[model samples]
Target: MHTPSHDWITTPLTAALLRGALDVERTAHGLLPHRLPARARAQFHDPQLAMAESQPSGVRLAFRTRATAIELDTLPTKRVYAGVPPRPDGVYDLVVDGRPAGSGSVAGGNTLTIDMTVGGAELTPGPVGTLRFAGLPDAEKDVEIWLPHDETTELVALRTDAPVEPAPDPGRPVWLHHGSSISHGSFAATPTTTWPALAASRGGVELINLGFGGSALLDPFTARALRDTPADLISVKIGINLVNADVMRLRAFTPAVHGFLDTIREGHPTAPLLVVSPLLCPIHEDTPGPSAPDFSRIAEGELRFKATGDPAERAAGKLTLTVIRDELARIVEQRRADDPHLHHLDGLALYGEQDAAELPLPDGLHPDAATHRRIGERFAALAFGEAGAFAQRN
Candidate 1:
């Protein structure tokens, strides 16, 4: 491990040095970036939300320096599943002057062991580790170190060969997005490659991603968090979580969706708000969920999910992707008359049946890395293009 010496300069990991995070928590070990504010966190708490918010999906350290070597000390909480192959270490991506520079990972950290069969988790504490990146151009330029999207990483320390100052703002519009796991980059190869991150890059905007795995169920606290956040362009991708978790019926979902949008409009009434429906997931397309893991392939090191609710249950108000999409479209249409800036985008346009046929969802849910890239590219063209809803008007 590289140790900080007299020649090295250490910088404090403060809010000014971070982006895409709503709050910075001072932990026993280090500073933890949270996607949701402290007040929102206080209202409701879940293990899934806690883990998701702490992962720092789109969060990055931003600075300008001539340093050729950089070292970051982090204590990452890695997730492990019993009786399955170990997942690779979360990746730390380095971007210099707005371009991919290098990548690395920490070897050891705390582990959260999860047993899918019983729906239980156990945390085993581990030691802090270091991530090192060296051999840069040695010229003054913008630097960004994107944290691991899937790991709960606490920033312990930052050191570099040369001094670093907060990078000058590029003056891009800030985009705040809320959605489910796919939006959270579940199968993405790296933090930067996450669909939202990629879309932000292509759209020339700053991103604050609030995509929680299995937690985007139209919670009021989350709506308030979005309302409180500062954003120029905003989008809410709904449906999958509500369906798969079987949290709400159609009777409850419509009002919840309306209320969610209403709360956001309270803060950003005219900020080109886009309402997006669910992407194509055949398992839950027509069938209602409460999805459950299929452990049959567990011995082969594969885990898949199946919808548990019957399709006939929809008659009694059980929600599904098909029903949710139609409701979302109707809701947006109903509100757009009074709110000119409000618009709707069918998730199918981004990743529909045709695209799914070409690049099927690997685990039957989240999009793969290539699919993420395709979605990002398609989103950029659809939502940020010249004729798109979020296009900059002259």
Candidate 2:
């Protein structure tokens, strides 16, 4: 519909430079084997119950010919993952003609769209939905797009003429993170860029996200999970879950955290471990979690929920962050002489004082993506910054 500029066609040298070290490919649904050979079966191995229980999922193939000039014509499947509770969404990082031109996120229910920008969501195609990338260095190159899960989603035919290339070495550093739902990315936008993921990207570390939503109790299983995962830097965001779940009293909470650390130290004796308390949450900050269902809510259509723990049991200072954090500090202080590697970082650093004053929880619960970004930025500056002990060579 518009006239092309005389300089629309890029120079061949430009194309060659953009297509440096070409390697690309496409599969119906699976990890990019060529790029992630080491983690070829990672998605399959984890097999989250949430993903397994979903219905009608599939993937598609798309390629592009020109380095810069590209368009998204159509997609494979769209009517998928309909029943799943939390919908999947993220920007697809695109490898155009063997080089990283940009990526896009999928959008719309039936039709699909592609954005030529980093962290951009997929767009749906209309009569004018066909996207065109100008100023393309004229060259024949393979293009490949990657997604996490293959099955249980709508992925129609991929659009591209370029050949698939190998995965780009992300060169991520190592970050070990632990926490409850908030840390587990309960309300974050996507999987890769959760607060931990965002922090890792900023800090340049590989992330072992041990942020299990509603699962990070002071349980031995959790310590075992931490003990097992490989980590260069470690962090445990504790408190909120235990407080809300009302799982223990002060006495039990104290020893449980110590015991948890004891078990983790058995494996990562020297790894720098940061113990982060819960961020500022109102519902459970000071109020004792109800041990019995608030039947009044159910009667009023509020969907009453059963109490997770006994309130009377926690009345004896048996369950509280103040107590937990104090005990943690004491434990670390006591062991610092023998275990110089252990470290403690308060959660407030990430979302304390000024942050809580400015940015409050939306649902009286978890922080939104903006808060996640704020926390990630601060964490990168504090826990993983150049001055961070984790940055020190052990």
Candidate 3:
């Protein structure tokens, strides 16, 4: 595809405007978005870490162009969960001049199918594909293509009818957020519609999302990454991952929380730092984890998570969702006495028992698309609204 005014000029996708991913690696074919830097990634080889970090949640290409037609070539690694409904193709959202203009999806890509029952995964390789968009206004304007939050994508090339360049910073304050899978867009409908994405949109903030799936376990490395990242506003949503993964007992958790915040404050002592607790997860509220799948549903062509740890274990210092929330609240209250910018938001305020009853979580874990929308809207109103914490700054 060629235009008289311009020959194809493929700009090297550098880190200048690639907001979400922490690091990009040169792959054999193209570039791979790694949520964690090489130093951190080298420390852990867990498949869960690999899968979550590679999803590229909140990743996108942002630039300016006069092109009426644009083509993006990418090699995506799509995930398929066996026995559950086939996940839809990951969506790429195109925003022209700050408003949604169109959307596209790559046709073919590699497939990673996971059988949770047996804890096995297999990848079937596929080839690169292109997403072409035309019929633009044909004037200089900002253009953004948000990559699918659920799929890992490798950029092959980008072409356009007109020359492309980095989009100018819009001067919005950057919001750097870190949380668990729910924040990583577990069941959000599209890349831009993820709860955090939606909230960022409504709040009019530049987003640098650090939302890793099950990987938000308050690790020192993640804290260091947050410390190093530049931002005007920062938020850390904790608790859910700790409960679900059941990785630490209360003895380790309390101080871990302090250390995480301590490290972040090292770099951003005055930035508005909001610590969010877990939302309502009934199964894990009183019961401890690590959560396991209910295989009974697979027989019916469905799958859901169930808490496996005994509730009685809580007396022995086992962490549950309930216990985690109280601890987080206490920690934030104690710290805010000296750190005035620090704050806490009960995750239940985002999604409570009533909200769950109305918009039930399909997997007994992650919220569905509708729930995502509700939470996004509420969060925008609470955290970004006129009387909200981010309101005055923005």
Candidate 4:
């Protein structure tokens, strides 16, 4: 807790000062940013979805200020698995004039312990913590405090030496993207370094990310939420979560993909819509899943994942990354006959066989920080560069 200072000016945390969040929920302690609106959240009861949506993967506090010193009070919910050592505290990245200025993390907040084997969790309350950045240039500039990508944080207070106001819109095209854990910044080191966030920066676009951790199952409610959102460019990266969860077979997967796209078109019929398939996961490239945790290295404080289903199951309509990609390509090709703005990108183009050989997925699932940068760079080139699907029209 920070002591009250006479020189500090307190600002009310309002929705207008936030970006990339679909809703601002009033909590007992403060305001919580949610990626899914209340109505869309009401349609699902899954705890994974709830947790992922509240984690604020791409959400940030934005404003214009001349403050040389700034402090933000937040209540962050940190997660711990039962057997593994506690993960590092989530990072808060500060950006000034669209460039990285500094980074910090709250010291303490709340704790949530989870037993993955039993699917149970225990919550422990903790005190709010403050993140401070000082010695900034005292010139007028746009500032943004990016929340942690993996921790649920509630904004309790905003304090600065100088007054602040909501930043004016930059007038960039808005890019709304939906994907799975990789897109959700699973193994990303910081909020601003996430692949989607990096890509958005390079593309010169505003980002509204709906990449839920383990909850990107292409739910109808999610589709509707995407539909209702206003954006100029849209993309959906599919397959990883579906394959790992084993939620649907080939028969169900194809129609679900089509339906998800159909819903988005209802709101953005002319927007550039790009459909991306899964990246190269050798374990699930041909084999089906029901991925299982590989706890063999748990004693070493390392956890890995493996595909549990057999490759032969593909004959029975089992879904795999390769299968999903083929089907997605076919679906996009067929739909393009009627929809000229629709496009398809094979996820391998972002991270292919050569990439897996060089920078293998640390957990046999999500990419590491280096891979995130590579993917982000590749995506920006393919989606926003000249002649790309989302290339700005003259």
Q: How do these models rank on TM-score, best leading?
A: 4, 1, 3, 2
**Collision pairs in model 4:** none
Off by over 4 Å in 1: none
Clashes of 3: 0
List TM-score per model, in order: 0.98, 0.60, 0.96, 0.99
User: Which residue pairs clash in candidate 3?
Assistant: none
Write candidate 3's Cα lDDT for 1-394 as tens digits: 2222356666776776476788999888788887888888888788987888888877888898899988888899988889887888999999988899988889788999999979999999998888889899989999989999989899877888788888888899989999999999998989899999999999999887888888889999889889988898899999888888889999999999999999999999999998989999999999999988898978787888899999999999999989999999999999989998988889999999999999989989999999999988988888988877787778
Candidate 2 accuracy as TM-score: 0.60
- Number of the predicted model whose lDDT against the real structure is largest: 4
Question: Could you tell me which 10 consecutive residues in candidate 2 have the lowest summed lDDT?
Answer: 13-22
TM-score of 3: 0.96
Query: Native-vs-model 1 lDDT?
Result: 0.92
Candidate 1 per-residue lDDT, tens place, 62-139, comes to 999999999999999999999888988999999999999999999778999999889899999998899999899989
**57-96 in candidate 2: lDDT tens per residue?**
1111334355455444223223222112323443343445
lDDT of 4 by residue, 177-293 (tens): 999999999899999999999999999999999999988898999999999999999999999999899999999998899999999999999999999999999899999999989
